[model samples]
Target chain A: MQGTLSVSVWRGGEAGSFQSYEVPRRGNQTVLDVVTYVQRKLDGSLSYRFACRVGMCGSCAMMVNGRPRWTCRTRVSRVASSGKLTIAPLRNLPVIKDLTVDMTDFFDKWAKAGGVFKPTATRAEDFAAIRPTDSKRRHADAGIECIGCGICYAACDVVAWKPGYLGPAALNRAWTLVNDTRDGNGAARLRAVAGDDGCLACHSQQGCQEHCPKHLNPTAAIAGLKRAVAVAALKGRL
Target chain B: MSAEKLQTCLWLVQRISASVLAVAVAVHLITIIAAVQGGLTAAEIIARVGGNGAWAAFYGVFVVAAAVHAPIGVRTVLQEMTPLPNFFVNALSALFGIGLLIMGLDAVSILYRLGGG
Candidate 1:
């Protein structure tokens, strides 16, 4: 914590190399602080994305030492124990610049996976009282906190292997909707997540669950989708 | 069938067949171990299993489970690993499943016939 840390940051687009920059290490320093220092002081052209310095905004996530992590919450002392840090754009995504990735496909897949909620009742209808202790509500609550962070998406090998496959975050969103008692899109949602590119495509690797900064389990959500799909198929509703 | 329905059905088939294979494999392994431990010779084993209806039925179910389970697994691997067209992958998977079924049933038939049926 008293010495300069050797930080290797990625520069350029699809074709690029790691540019090493030495930064003064301090106690309680986050990886985001290191990147900010490099961009502000060392190099003004260094490109990255971050809104809140805290972990609320998922935009600060990047590949920290070959793992997708929210850099704002990731302490340098914990990650770079060897006094060396390798920071790069998130994997399984298109790199736009140094540390920023093109998130078009990531969010697009979320829509494709039926992550959008449909209303069963019109605005004139009375509010559907869903108790917090309800099993379905509880199930929905478990995965509803996801802030569209691509950490799970980047961590997924299935996403890396099959580009069309709906990644974990999207499926996790779908799961939350599936458990929503007021949601009107149950049948369509099941259909959307049924095929090879949907829930069935998940290899249950739990990479999404493993790296989720929100501590959500997309794997379990996907498994739930699989069961729902199977039930629908059996009931001739799919 | 629609692609979604077909994929879901295939997933169901794989899961069901895998369950069957799980039981079949356990039974097969246990039988092998028991036979070996009992000091049964090749001829003695054949004498007990060749003409036995129960053994034939068990093995017949085992072979079917394996045939169903393996081809689906093979199809998944081919689809994920190769850049093959979906049509070609489906065709190859179907052919593979048929081949496994034919070969498996044939082997079972031979064993059944060894009992002079």
Candidate 2:
């Protein structure tokens, strides 16, 4: 890893092509380090987004070689051991610039899936006691750590195939909200996610689960949504 | 019906029909293999199945389950793969299911009537 690495970075809008740049390889280099090298030294005009340079922000996600990955956490030695790398913007979203994608649609779908929590009780009414071992609480806790990184969205085939379909991350958020015992939007949320473009559209491919940096299972969350929708429909609630 | 309810009901119907089909297909395949292995003639097979209420019911259920299952799957594929309108897809899938049901039931009815039932 002592030689200069050949890196091809996407360099424009939707119709742009990859631009090659050579950067000195370091022993413990990340893909973000390569992009930063290109931006700071090789070409000052290159555009990309990253915060915290660690994995927490999830703002540095890009397609590494062909799959959606958080570039900040991905090791160059691990992905591009052959002294070559291809980095591009996340798929299934509009490219804003070189490596930046428009996240408006991603957030819009989250809203459509009722990802927001609807509180049932006021502060004056005292806190709702939810046991840690409660089945519903455990189900909610399982999917509560989503960071809205859009990696799951980028990795979902259903989202790529049907633009109207709410992707895995949005559906996963809805699942967590649905399982919240104190939430007041259960019926409406179930109805929202029961549509043709919602949970039913998922093929259970597990692409989101596989690509998730946090190892979260959006497929399982979507399955939970499907079951909830089915039960609500059967009970005449949806 | 609303699109959400329709989609949910279709999903339920497809799953239930698939369950029925799982058992029916196994039984149908086993019966076919047994008949072929025992060297039963077409006429002899007809004699055994024709006018038999139990066999008629079994085949009837099998045909119904297949009629329900295949068309829903086809509808999903059309919706996802093709650029067709939703209304057109629904109508086309419904017609396909109806056609299957009619043809399958007709075949079963003819077999039932062949032995004077």
Candidate 3:
């Protein structure tokens, strides 16, 4: 590894260009650490957003070498192509500033996809027993770990092609909720996700699956929705 | 039907028609290959299948499947590639489906009527 690393970061909002900076390379340094150095020491005006500095927050994901990745977990040595790095805001989103895209659309779509769980029973009732080994529980377990990192959403070609289309994160969350037997919103949730720009719009390209840090498959969830929607269509319930 | 319901209905139509087309295409190909290798002339082929109710019914099903299947696929492509709204896409899909239905059924009828004994 060289003593100095050359970094090129997107320096402004949607219309801006890349700005280069040189930082000292050190052992165990992450991409976030490099950005911190340039911002704290070299240029205070350079803007970015992060909170936990760990992988749990899912707020530090950005484009690294033209691929969306969680920069908090991404080590500099692993992704520094040609001894250089390029960092930018996630694609297919409205860039608010350097390395930060507005998340309103992402969260709004999640709501539109029925991402929230609704309780089927009132608080007066006893706690519902959910067997972990049950098929629905197993199905939900396979897709419930999404951190809303927006990496999968950014990686999705469907989102890029159609602005109105619900991206992968929202669809994945809908799939999990759809599997939740305790959730009382099955009919409504299914309706929400079966729209023209909902789960039915997914092209099954698996870009979301390939880029997901949680290893969850939104494509599979979408396939489930496709089957469910078809059944609903046949029954005249859709 | 509501727009959302129509979209879902089209999705079902596309999938079901594709399954039918799979069988139709395979049977059609195998029959063409067998008849050609057996030195069946156009007149001979027509004499065998022409005016046959069973042949007419089979081809009728093929025409229906293709008519429904082709339009939905094109609609999806057009929707993804262009900025056209859902209304325009639906309109295009309906037109394409109607056009395919008319042309395909016409061809099926002509083949069944040929060399009528």
Candidate 4:
């Protein structure tokens, strides 16, 4: 508690190396604060990403001590047991720089999962009243708050093994649309999340559920997708 | 059927086979335990299972379920861990599934024949 913390921050690109730094341990200091200190005081060339400094913004996600976490909210005291921390870029995605990863692939997978919703009605139609207490609406609401942090995608083993996998975040988003009664993209979206690289590829290991900072259960959403795809396949829609 | 359709069917088959295996394994283990309590000797156990229509039928179901389930699991693992293409992986996986069925059926037939089927 009184000594300087030994922090190993990954520097450079995908083929980069970890550079160790001695950062002063402070009371209630977050991991992002530690990185900032290393950047301002120790080294000027250090690169990391953070925006809101609060948990709301998903831009601050990084691998903190081997687990994907929002560095702005993650405290050094909570993660650094031995006063040592290893910070790196998110997994299952290409690293852009020191601690920043290329989110293009992540969002591309999101699009591949049919994350975008197609309206069942146009602006000419009146507001389609969907009851808040409806089962499908409730189901949609469960995974609707995803901030696209790419944390779940980083934690997924299937994504690690199978690069073609849509990962959890994309699948969870697809699930929200699958429940959206107003979303005209039903069978098409289900078909998108079907094949070997789709929702069926998930091993249901719940790694995404476990590491999700928002507490969103992608595993459950994926199970819903599986059932939906099966029904669609049976009905000859997929 | 399309590729996605085939993948979904394979997934369904794996799940259904897994359910079948769950029951079959439980029954098989329970029966083995019960029969063993009566004496686990080869002669005694063979006598209990021998000439039993119900036991043969149960084992036949087990063999079929296992044949379907295991190869799918293997195929998934191989697909994830290996860089093999779909065509090669599919052919090999199908052949493996067939091989399992052949081996499983052979065992079942032997058991039935020995049991005086």
Candidate 5:
């Protein structure tokens, strides 16, 4: 709501530079507002990805001041230090352009970890009546709300090191799928996540949990995955 | 080995070597720092190593442990950072571990025989 805010936005792909922009401050302004203003008014070439202007879409994630967050949810008032902010694309992914990372690798790791729900019963069969309060359902409930945001992925140091590693979000999704009573592929899923680049590789740095906007504990989910895999391996099913 | 078994092996080795190296390096560094701080002469150092069989044995263990430890760390770094072929990476790290053992033993020998400590 004052003179100007100093904004440094990443301008290229993986190898890029931060271009500085000055925008007039406004009240209750979100980080996405700042980026939008700079792109629409200041410079037309600046590129960033976002769908729903609200926080639900999870597409507006960027590294703001060295931490990945949803720009739509993160207010400038909360993050701006000395009225300056640095915005860059999510880390550990190939940057397609400024503030946009190619999520193919991230999503591919999800599939590799067997995140997809493999139903045990056909629709012709009776519908599975899973009590909402059941232990497995509760466990799945804890992680089922993930918005596919790459914030946790960007915050993870292990992913940076092991490029093949299935990241927190993917592993979290797998955990939910594992707990689904209808899922028939639990043993196979456990096998897939038991390998070198899978659930066993997580160092439990808690970076994913710390930076997740949804407050989802992917680390805990991953720990459960590890236990599940170990059990399956011991049982000779994995 | 199955991928799960391989991962388990790596996890076990890393922890075991880390525990061994922690004690060895701590004693080594503390000894060096204490010697320097006390202004102990080279002759005094030599006399201790030459006469103290226990100290020689301790250092021998330290050397072997370090040899086992450092290469595993380097191997982890290589695994994380580079796109080098897997077989070559494992081979090179094994060679490095062996090299460390040879150098460590050689140094211990020099300390015991030539230094007369």
Candidate 6:
């Protein structure tokens, strides 16, 4: 922590290359801390996005050493070796600039997966009174904590291989909504995530599960969606 | 075809082919070991398969499975490189798969007749 850490940051869009930076290290330094220091003290032109430095916002996800991770939670000591670090924008997304990627496409795919929940009731209607112990609620609870971080979206190889793929994060969101008993669009959501570039596109690679900071198993959710879609397809409901 | 139906059909075909291939490949391996252990000569192997419809059928299924599986795999690789529609790509690959089946069967048939099973 006394000597300066050698860092290489991706300085431009997809056509750009990594630029090296030497920054003084401090104790308990996180990767996000290093990036902040580089932008504030060393290079004011550096571009990055972060909010709620405590790791709740999920805005600071990046490819740290070729792995998608939340930099806010990653300690420099854990990732940095030989006093060197390489940080890049998340993979499979259009990079806007240094350490920042255009997330519009990621969210657009999410919308294509019907990520929004369509409720059956209005404010005039009484509460549907869903039981917490219900199996559907329990299933939804398992994957409902996603923060739209794009970590899983970036980690998915299927998304990279098939750019039109709805990806794990989007399917995870759709799965939660599918399990929402109050949602009237379960059938439609099932149909949306049914075919190629949807839940079926997932090869059960489990990369999303491996890199998710929240420990949510999008792989399992996608599997469930596959099963649901299969049933619906067989029954002509999809 | 509807996208959902097409996807399900592909999944079903792959799954069924995988199951069939598992059994066919095991049988083929065991048969090879037996043939070798029995000191089977070229003529002896031909005697077993020259007009044996059962052996031809077994090899026929094996060839078809190989054709289906290899092309499906190649299609996946091509999909990553080319943004072609799955329908056009998969149908083209299926034609290629059929060609492989025809070539494999023709070669097997010739081996049966030429004392080289």
Off by over 4 Å in 4: B37-39
Docking quality (DockQ) for each candidate: 0.84, 0.78, 0.70, 0.86, 0.28, 0.55
> Model 3, stretches more than 4 Å misplaced?
B38-52
By DockQ, the better pick of 1 and 3 is 1
TM-score-wise, the better of 1 and 6 is 1
Q: How much lDDT does each candidate structure score? A: 0.91, 0.91, 0.88, 0.91, 0.86, 0.87
Between the candidate structures 3 and 5, which one is better when assessed by TM-score?
3
Candidate 1 lDDT, A125-169, residue by residue in tens: 999998899999999999999988699999999888788898999
Indicate the DockQ of the complex predicted as candidate 6. Answer: 0.55
Better of 5 and 6 by lDDT: 6
Candidate 4 lDDT tens digits, A196-224: 99999998999999999999999999999
Better of 3 and 5 by DockQ: 3
Task: Show the lowest summed lDDT stretch of 10 residues, model 4 chain A.
Answer: A48-57
lDDT of 6 by residue, B1-117 (tens): 787777766665666788899999899888878777558687777776666767888888888888877777677677776878878888878888889989998977886657534
Could you tell me every candidate's TM-score relative to the true structure? Answer: 0.97, 0.95, 0.93, 0.95, 0.78, 0.90
Q: Candidate 5, fnat value? A: 0.34
Model 1 interface DockQ: 0.84
Ranking by TM-score: 1, 4, 2, 3, 6, 5
Residue range B18-115, candidate 5, lDDT tens digits: 89878888987888777664577777778657546687788888888778777767776787788887677788888999999999888788778865
lDDT of 2 at B17: 96
| lDDT tens digits, residue span B1-117, model 4 | 899999999999999999999999999898888768656776776677766888778888998999899888888988999999978888888899899889887887777677677
Q: Candidate 4, residue A184: CA error in Å?
A: 0.3
RMSD of each: 1.4, 1.7, 2.2, 1.6, 4.6, 2.6
The CA root-mean-square deviation of candidate 2, after full C-alpha superposition on the true structure, stands at 1.7
lDDT of 6 at B114: 70
